[model samples]
Target: MPADADIRERLEAKAFELGFDQFGITEAATSEQIVAGFRKFVELKRYASMEWMAERIHQREHPQNLWPEAKSVIMLAVNYGPKDDPRLLLDKKDRANISVYARGKDYHDLVKKRLKAFARWIVPEFNCDLKVFVDTAPVPEKPLAAAAGLGWQGKHTNMVSPEFGSWVFLGAIYTDMELPADNPHRDQCGSCSACIAACPTDAFPQPYELDAARCISYLTIEHKGPIPEEFRKPMGNRIYGCDDCLAACPWNKFAQASSEAAFHARVELNAPELGDLVGLDDKSFREVFSGSPIKRIGRDRFVRNVLYAIGNSANKAYLPQVRTLLADDAEEVVDAAQWALEELS
Candidate 1:
């Protein structure tokens, strides 16, 4: 049997073998800083339409609250860096710019499977129980990740790794073993404000803060109604999630492009024509996005996003596509279609 220190070292080695780009360990404890920040975030309504965040505040405030027996947390990061600069697609006004992360297989499924495999190996070898989590859990992934020395949270409030930059997907494994914790990472974002300046919607009120209500990702993915007219033009051709902040990080200078085929962009998803996307009805939408993360928002919300993109497109070519949805049963879709037609006209 190996010593606890040896187990810690081997666990990290096994994590890299399992495809996680980075790994670190931290004791599972109540995080008052996380609680204070979350309270303020919810108090200010910064979570936008994500009422679930407010509902799960208690569980998020402390890791032990979620699982009492959890003695340590193993935070892992997987790089999903794009083969080409994701921002280059913005210049193609007639095409929709799906965020790089969403262009591949659903990360929740991929990361969770990898984590479960690691957890399965851990249980038998270490004789300890564990639980794995991706984004779906109420875990404070970023703070715990930073605490585990994976990376410091950047001005964009996303973890920025020295190796993977902002292109890393985070997951966690909580175990009963009291593993040695890695030294916490310190804030390395100094003087530079590229992420703040890159916001198309002025989503950042200040460095390290976000108003999700005005975030393009929130409007396109979470907000389930007619997009406020104010954001339509700034949204540009981005029909799914926005990547401006992530793409603007200077730390990406050290980032390596992801080699995972599972994270590579699907040809059909890369810069898809707005005309093609605007025509997707319910059946076709499901068919096209069958295994993609975009499917979760449903056809109505997706068409709504595309209509906003078409409105901002300044190309008359998509006017007919917008017109086709003028009588859509989803009131928000009809509203967006009308708005897009008026803008294009």
Candidate 2:
């Protein structure tokens, strides 16, 4: 077996070669701070309808609890920072605003493939068992990454890296081999409130805290049923996830666009016409968003989101699109259309 320092050095080199922008090592133990914060978020019902956070609290709070044999966690970051500002799309109300992360190939697939590649190379050399995770697993990714010194959890509650800003996708490899852990990062977001002020829905109830129930990302994506009337106007043209808080981060000045081709924005998804997207039936929806993460929500939820954007657009041209969905089989879609029609009227 290789020395811990030697393996750590080679692992980082391999990670970068595999297109990961940052790499760090941390012990597979959860911090009390992370557990406390998560419990508070859950206790407040801020996790919204995602009850799974509470369900898998133990696994999410403790990395060792997740995998007893795991001794080290290799935290990695892949920069998906947009070539141009994602916020620019917000002004074009006729055009739908897909978040920067979703405008390209799904990072879950892209990041996981690279993570497995790195794991394959390391496992044989170090003679250790390993497991990998992207976002789907109940992993304490941000807190673990911060503990690994890859970044610090910003006031926006997203991990903010000095080099990648908040636009990086995180993944982890849990290995039984012991690795030298990196020094934990200290908070770098001193006296800055830009991210807090950028929220259209006022999602931040306090600094460094978020009410996910009120988040545009949650409302348009994870949330089922019609969005509350109070949040619809603030949802604006963001038919998918919202990036205002991420874009508002001052650390982003150091962020360069991702070099990975797979992460680059797709032209069609960029500023897509609300009218065009709203017209997508189940078949066409699958065809258009075939490999994109947006496809997961299916046509019903997606069309519902587009209708809300149309209503907020104040552009009567999309009224016909809204009308066509008035009788959608999905109750949420019909409710969204009716609400949109009323808003537009």
Candidate 3:
């Protein structure tokens, strides 16, 4: 066998042994094809209040520009699928739904740790310097993963592994090691509009373009102020991230539940009672979600999300719970709570 072929095989085996669900390697090459579209998207101010996206527009669109020394990027995907569709709880009006991704340990920490280990192993073998990232850097992970033959970028602008759908969390190791690049995956979303249609806020302006401003995920996690009333009703029971678009993907039928114990859904997070969540004081909230991704949003934004869910509950039983938060110290939380209480009353 060729030396490079043997190295690639060894790398894949090592990745599997390290618990990464999928691995692919791609050369650090820039794609000018998508640059114009990405620029247009930014020019249209579709990034909403994410000023960082505007600031790093050029770097994000071109991977090599981020690190000129990087010769290859090893794209890794770790499955975080839940035993049940996260969207199933939407009909349970009194419950708050946390996105599958945030149900367990924070992925940023988990993925970065694993990537560091993988990099350490590779450095000795290839004598290369490695830098790792897990959504923390300007790395265009989804596009790079596609270029690496890991999967195609779905219309939702998330990587959709044919093996795991959109349930994979992406991580990358930028290395100076010269490795053979894998063939890119083809777009498998033929004649499918489920993701686009399922978005409550119509976040997708076109097949492959997403206006982050209208996305519920952005509103609940990234946007810090009051959520517009228009999108609240359609927000349904989602208290954190929205998974409707992801669940709607046809490829999900092929997805298996993730084997990583750290990615498993905590029973409490799966279908938390809106009343219970709203009743949590800052200390209790931190203690309950200590190691989970939800804690990063802090108590105020989390309570704001819970209030939106409470308003959409249509269950009068939660009115008292929503009412208690009406005088929350945080202005944003209090505003949302008052609006929810008024709507439910």
Clashes of 3: 0
Model 2, TM vs. native: 0.98
Query: Over 4 Å off in model 1, which ranges?
Result: none
Give the lDDT of residue 63 in candidate 3: 67
User: 2 or 3: which has the higher TM-score?
Assistant: 2
Compute each candidate's TM-score over C-alphas: 0.98, 0.98, 0.97
Which whole-number lDDT from 0 to 100 does residue 240 have in model 2?
A: 96
lDDT of 3 at 149: 92
Model 1: residue 28 alpha-carbon error in angstroms: 0.6
> Which lDDT tens digits does candidate 1 get at residues 112-203?
99999998899999899999999998999999999999999899999999888899999999999889999989889899999999999999
Give the Cα lDDT of each candidate. Answer: 0.91, 0.91, 0.87
For residues 1-345, write the lDDT of model 3, one tens digit per residue.
349999899989999888899999998875776677679889999988989888998788876778878888899999998788877888898888888899888999888888888988987877779789999777888888999998999988888889998899999988887889999999998989899999989999999899988999988999888888888888888889899999989899999999898888787887888888888889999999999989988898898888888887767887777777777789888888888877878
Candidate 2 RMSD to the correct structure: 1.0
Evaluated at residue 289, the lDDT of candidate 3 is: 95
TM-score of predicted structure 3: 0.97
